[model samples]
Target: MKNKSGSFIEWLIPFCFILCAGWLIWHLPAFTLDWVPPDQSQADNLRGLHHRNDVTPGMSGPFGGEADWVDYLALLGLPIFLYIGIRTVRRAPMEFESWRPADRVSVFIGRVTMMMIILLTSVMLYEVLLRYVFEAPTLWANELSLWLAGFVFLCAGLYAMQQRSHIRIFLLYDICPRWMQRLFDTISTVLIVLFAFFLVYGGYGEALDKLWRWETFGTAFDPPIPATLKPTVLIIVSLVAIQAVVNLISDWNAEPVIHTAADDIDQDELEKIRAAVGAEGVGDLDVTRGSIQGNQTERN
Candidate 1:
């Protein structure tokens, strides 16, 4: 009981951290560090000889101060998110050995990738702050951040898949018998694995197009990063697909036991039994009287 209680506490700690991180990310855009106006004066200053008729674009518009400020904040906020993610993954209860071999690698990869994100976040912070704030903004920071985000997303997906912790509504599964639950598990696993495979295959062309075009944000935010994220996406998807296969096999051979319902007496009977057990505290006369009553009832 004590061991189970400790495990429960461990699980709750990470859950709470994730909840808070999500809240902060949701409100990040609403809280900006600087307020800049985008009126006519600001637009005139931003305008340069690059314009054909010397007419300035609207300040605080799409390419205006507000957008850049928000993006910069996002650049800052992403690190906090990455740090929380890393800590959560690192401190996650490690029962991976109990998992299937195929699934174990996915878990390992997910956790390590999380660590990499932390390191990458630090590098990105340096690049962005030094180049933009102190001196001048560099094209590298923008690309680097995007690349890191891509990996972070892909790794997170695999992690979720490995844990079998994805969003699922188990209303029907809750009441299902052991055999039926096993059937559903098998079917679900096959479907998910196939779906991931197709996604990998389909994403390849899009990835290639982005790579060929040497995509850039057409602003101060550009990087020479490769467009080979298709392979990364495919690999992560395949890992998840394999993890599903592992889960399917594990469920196949495992005992189909319901966790909550122990084969003890029902609640009412248990309460009666508790009362009878407590009756030992009464005087000997009461105990003798109860025994006599029980004897008479049995005889009847």
Candidate 2:
């Protein structure tokens, strides 16, 4: 068991990442809202809730908060993510093998999203406890969960690219010649980049404007969710764009992973089924294999 111990080097790099993220969040004026008196800040708009002051003309979205809950939750959550990232790297180096610098960023953000999921669950539990057990409810819980969930959805796209887990029509793709395969990859990546470019280009100014003006959500618990979330749209798509480009470059020279009729079959899986039913070995599956071949012949 002593051999299982990890050295400081295993965690050092991830620790530095978490530390830098924490320091930056701590220094941001928006997150510093905790230090200021609640009454003085937009957070103080609670208690009465429905006044025209809280729900102004058009600052916030449907939820109505002044700032994102992530500003507060990130400090606590990012370290957990960093720790997970370090462990993942140590345990599954192949997952990140051949990763470029930008790929690492997407992986980091993806890991953070996992941690955020846990925190989001906790927030829901806390809200339930407060509302039922304590007979008190928070104005922020509903809005905060939505805000966190939105980011999780947005960031997962980048993560899927990093993992190469997105859906694809491998039936046609695998049958294509090597040159055609590269052409397909190139075309897919170009389309993704163009889509990302248009999204960022169309939304960048408004999103930045909302964040810069410190826009409010016009709710009693008023958080800056609109300002933060809008900008995140541009940011997340940009990361996805970068990850797409990285994938194209990194996979350009990858050996073709051709799929065959036999490759589509699962011999090991059939063996597992056979064993589960008390078969002695794959030799007991003679009929099964024959039946499969017969079916394929009929299909052809």
Candidate 3:
């Protein structure tokens, strides 16, 4: 019964997210067409939603309110979407090579970031199709894309740090002894923590103010990008710092790794290619099937 309940919840969360996303997209015409005059054809033709004339001052809902009651329900789903995002990441398979065991928090954020990318792409595609092909453009698509994109960038940074895939020059560190490597790692982690500390210290007040006021983009669509993104930047940077500390502790007594060009190669991708081309086709290439199979065995 416990397992069944758990499985049910697992399915329910994602289903809710899909429903929320679809609801928001469906209501975009109503939510963002506030600038349209009531007498205008566009205003009258928006699936019976009247023009929003009585503008509410300040954010009346979480991360800023939507156009009306219908829109507010979609906004209410944001927290649930965020929770499901975390759960998704925590449950993801750890397939990538990293210095430590997969950080569930970072992985969760990474999956959310991926979803944001897809959402961003869909928004852009929708905008492009409407503006060029259909002779109708949305006021909210650009702003919505920008909003999703900002979160994507911020979340990806934390994921990259957790995966140790962030930009770094290992030429000098590769030659260092294990103790020296540990020292280098410690110094780098300290620097990251300090950077995060000063950033939050300086921006906390401003971020808090914006979030409190729920600052909107001064545009037709009027998204709360500034309100949300400002606080998110500080939050994600702090997570990156914490993940760095975790990595340092996790790697303290680990084996010394030698950096090389081959380290950049993705074995899983190569395996896929080999599978697609078959043994005979792979033989035509430089890499041998024996070596590929050996790597797969070792990885498994």
Candidate 4:
């Protein structure tokens, strides 16, 4: 019963997003961020509700300068939509011999980013169809797609780390003894933590400022790109840091794996090829002369 309730809520969020997006597109004219005229202060209008100040007069207090209703729906929906996705998703480009809690979280976040790819493409497709088929194009589509793509790119680092797909030159570390390898790994993780901490430390202040001040990108749609994205940077960097720590812990007990040229090859893949061609010994005729002749003279 508990699991069922959680699943329902998870699916409900995306449904709400679809409804909100559809409603906004339908009632585009009724909504207007341009509450102020061009002759007046345009900056305040650009800041809109995202400002922490009384930019919109009576529209002040705690939720005063935040993004619009639809923007809120979009912001809230995307993460949950992705959260649902990673819950039952599979591995991506990288494979891991063992999975840790952090790896699981990163894998889930990675899948969420993958979901954003489809969503971003879909917005573009919607724009194309609307412009060509109906002779109308949306101004919001491009910005929406850009916003989604940003999250996809940022979250990808965490996904890569979780998958063990991030680039690493094993030249020196590979040849080290088991103890030395562990030491190297520890050193590497410490560096990552330090860097990650630095980012979070720097970005945290600005991110809070953005959220508190309700900053925005000041576009026509005026999505809270800065307001949302700033916090996301802190969150993403923190996740990366956590994953680094996770990697250090997970690999702590492992033996040093000495990589070779052969380690790169997928051995199971080679056997599949041999089996398909019925490959035997070196002189084995997996391909008959007749088959080759038939292949060469197919058009003849």
TM-score comparison, 1 vs 3, better candidate? 3
The clash count of every prediction, one per candidate, is: 1, 7, 1, 4
Whose lDDT is higher: candidate 3's or candidate 4's? 3
Clashing pairs in 2: 65-222, 65-223, 66-222, 66-223, 66-224, 67-223, 67-224
- Per-model RMSD to reference: 16.4, 10.3, 10.1, 8.2
Over the stretch 251-282, how does candidate 2's per-residue lDDT look in tens digits?
Answer: 99999986566654567676677776456433
lDDT of each: 0.55, 0.65, 0.69, 0.63
Off by over 4 Å in 3: 1-94, 97-102, 275-300
| Top-TM-score structure, candidate number | 3
> How many clashes (backbone atoms < 3 Å, residues ≥3 apart in a chain or on different chains) does model 1 have?
1
Per-candidate TM-scores read 0.49, 0.62, 0.68, 0.65
lDDT of 1 by residue, 1-300 (tens): 011112343344334433443333322222221243234553443232112211222324333433344344445555554454333332233232234455545644565565557657887888878886898766566666676687678878887776665776666886898789888998898898889878877887776555433333444543323434555677788888887777777667666654353533366576666576565634444576678878999999
Candidate 2 vs candidate 3: which has greater lDDT?
A: 3
lDDT of 2 at 250: 91
